[model samples]
Target: MTTLPAVSQHNPWTTLGAEVRYENNWIRVVENDVINPAGNPGIYGVVHFKGVAIGVLPIDAEGCVHLVGQYRYSLEAYSWEMPEGGGSPSVSPVEEAKRELREETGLLARQWRELLRIHTSNSICDEHGVIYIAWDMDQTESEPEDTEDLIIIRMPFARVVDLVLDGAITDAMTVAAVLKAQLLAERGQLPEDVAKLMLGR
Candidate 1:
């Protein structure tokens, strides 16, 4: 008989106490007093997000991508990014993605494929984000939220990739989606028709 080594999955940090520093409709701030993984006493602050973040990269049959530009209040700078918003926890992610696409760019995609899922920032918050690639699109009048004043631009998908690589696009979700979609197109990992459009073939 051979003995095998035990692989244990266990939590390392010991939570001695926790306090809610602040909370709002979108997030909650929690301060935790804990013993660290290194066994040192310390405190950790966490921002708990209320909904899933959704991002959509809408590519049309003409090998063009739609981008949205807005002045981010938090960053205090202008940013160009894929259509994105927070999805209500009660709704399906794809449904949310569809709604965000239509609201932000006024385009409805007949075909939808999920491209990536990631943690936006794990160190401070547990914000989960999902990105989708949309194609076979129909354009209509946009209905942006009252809180948003946006600018929409349509350009070649390749140009969008260049913007990301050239240090223009910084939104985490947009960056991840564009890079992943590019990789998929290059590796033949996407649907033949969609990949052709994305790669401008």
Candidate 2:
């Protein structure tokens, strides 16, 4: 038997004052004077994002997945993962996922399923993320943004999952989407055709 944890509907921390510390095109940093849940007075700094983060896992009919490789400026390292980008909150998440997939990998998907909604870093950042599983795609020419220098590759979906399990794929969105997709396929939770495609039946 599983016990459900009690959920709190009321907020515990009280905000006294808030000041913007920094602002940029993509983010705004704020410092808030607050009373902690333990009744202590303190300050909390948070990074607010300007847009919603989106990620797409495009699995082709051949049971292969497409990935985008790029050098992450913040981490100062090269990384390979599913196509991802930021999109305006005003637009639909699935629409943004489609744009990112086509822009980064030149793949247009006809089937789309929402996989997960996550906060990238809740303790300090309010960056919201949406991940999706996409299939039934057609290839086209990529149209990357001016700031992006990306490399695209395709490999077996199972091999991509192995990469995730082996610690080769560390991007949070990619890891979460891949593992959830695998579990869903194995448990028959996904659509029949999609499951068969994912499981390579």
Candidate 3:
């Protein structure tokens, strides 16, 4: 097994100050002052996080993967994304995933399995994203948030993989979740019960 580097020995810099440079609904930036181990003063950047995030790769009854299209103000355009959301202090990431799926696309899953947890942009942000695989999804009326406008879309599993290979699905968490699901499918690690609920099964 490959051993990972220790976090304590990774960055030997002492943070001096952190000032909020920008604030918005999607993200917030903080400018930081730091002193290096060599006794040199330096600056760093950080993002203060309010919650953890979750992304769900839902495989419907026909073995198709469900996605959502929404206008991301930060990107200034509409982009395809897996169902995702941030966890509040009062709720866990798993719960957040369920809520996000329903709110964004009005889909409900009869089965959910955690795939992985990823650290998104560890160099700057402190947010962690949990990835989940949802099977046996059923569609319903969407209930988007007050500020959200979303469109639901479903496509074959093969098409999703192609999109990832072609750089169409660029979101890190979504890509990770889909890849993990694919690997699990190949390895036959998915439980028979869950497999039976999958679209392709």
Each model's lDDT: 0.94, 0.93, 0.82
Q: Which window of 10 residues has the lowest lDDT sum in candidate 1?
A: 1-10
RMSD of 1: 4.0
**Residues 87-197 of candidate 3: C-alpha lDDT, one tens digit per residue:** 775687778889988888888888888899899889889898888888877789878888777778889887888898899988888888777777777678887755544
Off by over 4 Å in 2: 1-3
Which residue pairs show collisions in model 3?
A: 61-199, 63-199, 63-200
lDDT of 1 by residue, 39-152 (tens): 999999999999999999999989899999999999999999999999998999999999999999999999999999999999999999988999999999899999899999
Give the TM-scores of the predictions, in the order they appear: 0.95, 0.95, 0.86
User: Per-residue lDDT of 161-190 in model 2, one digit per residue for the tens?
Assistant: 999999999998899999999999999988
* Residue 68 CA displacement from its true place in model 3, Å: 0.5
